[model samples]
Target: MTYDFQDRVFLITGAASGIGRATALKLSSLGASLALCDINSTSLVTTTSLCTGSHFTHSFDIASSSECTHFIKDTISLYGKIDGIFNCAGINPTSIPLEDTTDEYWDMMVNTNLKGTYNITRAAIPFLKSGSSFVNVSSICGLHPFPTFAIYCATKYAITGFSKSMALELGPKGIRVNVLAPGFIDTPTNSGVIAGEEGVKSLEAKVSLGRLGSAEECADVVAFLFSDGARYMNGSVVEVNGGTAES
Candidate 1:
């Protein structure tokens, strides 16, 4: 599991917790320096604390276009180059039905999940050298419908399509782009919502593996994708779900 990315730089958003936090630590273990971004300053600090000091952190709103510009400028200026970029900052649209959904909620989901990713990747391309990787965090919801999560799923679907198109456009530059779609991962924030006794049983029943996923497990796949091991893998959607969704 050793990645030969020593001294390489990776920029990751949503690094404060969950999958983002796990990936940050995992990449650090593989010897990559990092520029971490998140809105949660307190939690973002904690995430960087788990890594080597060869990391810089920014507490900027991913939903803000101006802030995204400034964040990218600072990272490139500070690190000189970026070898990988992981777009993970996103909001889960509220579970209210479409009729009850507000303009604010729809805008929030689109801004954070869709526009935010566009901002960073678009800005970082000039800073990335050839053979760099771009990994966007998509979800199973993007592929399969979940009741009451329309906008959330839509954003993810857009990311999936967008990643494929970008992969082709950037391939000539030797920059690779891929998406990771994780299903039913058990993180602290989602523990209560998806991990109670009844909830757990229902989720387990839905998956052939009969269990939930862990953030650390998903991180492993992403680490490989970001490394030379996944060199031929571009314009791909790697599903980490436990046989819960079928192609």
Candidate 2:
């Protein structure tokens, strides 16, 4: 389905690569103005180069509230208003058992995955006008148990809960919120998982579709949620996992 975002402005975190980059390209093609954020300035430039519309790029760590506030302020200053936000900035945890998870590892996952989502969404809420929307990227781990991904699962589970609550709180004001749960997407984030033939086969076997998903495929769902097509979808968790973890 084709979506028209001619005059809309969108704020996207983690736009440097993976699903975020794909979403940026998709929305840009649909004629939307963009405010892209990423901590990696170099990779972000590459993403901006591939996009085809008016856009501004900001480099900042989303875990910092001050940076998030500044990024939102600057985005509004440049675009005048934000019509949607895609909270796709996140970190993948190593497949280590919870008992082996160190304090540093735990902190990094919580800060980047959970706290970062909170920081960005809290900062942008004031500027999100009526008819605006927010899409938070969770994971298949959020909805089902993954043996060695306890910490990662915790963060994504928190995101699912947080997005739902935000939808209720913001829905009455005309701002919609939803979550996207993606599984084994073929992106830099899963480079290790698809590194060797054995790894690829093992991962694919877990998916009902017998293959991994692509970043663009996940982006399609994100674009739909951000468009008027999903106007009635709020506090919903849409899975883009190739039938993995079906329940």
Candidate 3:
């Protein structure tokens, strides 16, 4: 379907790289105005340069409630309104067994991944109008298991649950909430996964498509979720894991 985002304004966290950057470019090409944010200011600027028409960029900690409020206010001040939001800012630190995980490490992951998503969503909710959609970035691990990635999996699972609940609460208010669960996407964020040729093959083998997916590929789905085409879709979890999700 042909997607057009003319005059629409979207707020995207984690726009510095990977699927977030790809989605910004995709939406911009479709004629949307963007408010992009990330903790990495340097890379966020690069993403802005790659996009087309009207856009703004911010570097902030999504984990901070005040920072999220500030960014949302700035977006409203510039665009006057928000049409949608993409909650993609997150982190995947070194994976270790649950027993080996420390309290500090747990707080870091929970704050950035789960609480960060919460911060932005809460801040932006009041600004969203009817038909606004929320496309939250989860992971295959959110739906499945990764032995040593307890904290990562926990945060992702929380996102899925949170998004679904938001959909139920916001649907009557004309807002749609959905989840994007990607698996082994070939982005700089996941460079370590496909580090060696052998490693690539091994990882790819787990996917029915027999390859790692691309950030751009995942971006396509994000665009659809935000488009008029998906007006009826709400509280749905869409997986872009190349068939890795259980049947």
Model 1 / residue 70 / CA error / Å? 1.5
Q: TM-score winner between 1 and 3, please give it.
A: 3
- Clashing residue pairs for model 3: none
CA lDDT of each prediction against the hidden true structure: 0.87, 0.91, 0.89
**TM-score-best of 2 and 3:** 2
Cα miss at 171, model 1 (Å)?
A: 0.8
Candidate 3 lowest-lDDT run of ten: 188-197
**TM-score top scorer:** 2
Estimate candidate 1's alpha-carbon lDDT, on a 0 to 1 scale: 0.87
Candidate 3 — which residues are off by over 4 angstroms? 191-194, 245-247
Candidate 2 vs candidate 3, lDDT winner: 2
Please give, for residues 48-151, the per-residue lDDT of candidate 2 as tens digits. Answer: 99999658999989989999999999999988999999999998767897798899998888988999999999999988889999999999888987788899
- In terms of lDDT, the poorest run of 10 residues in model 1 is 187-196
Arrange candidates by lDDT, highest first: which order? 2, 3, 1
- Order candidates by TM-score, high to low: 2, 3, 1
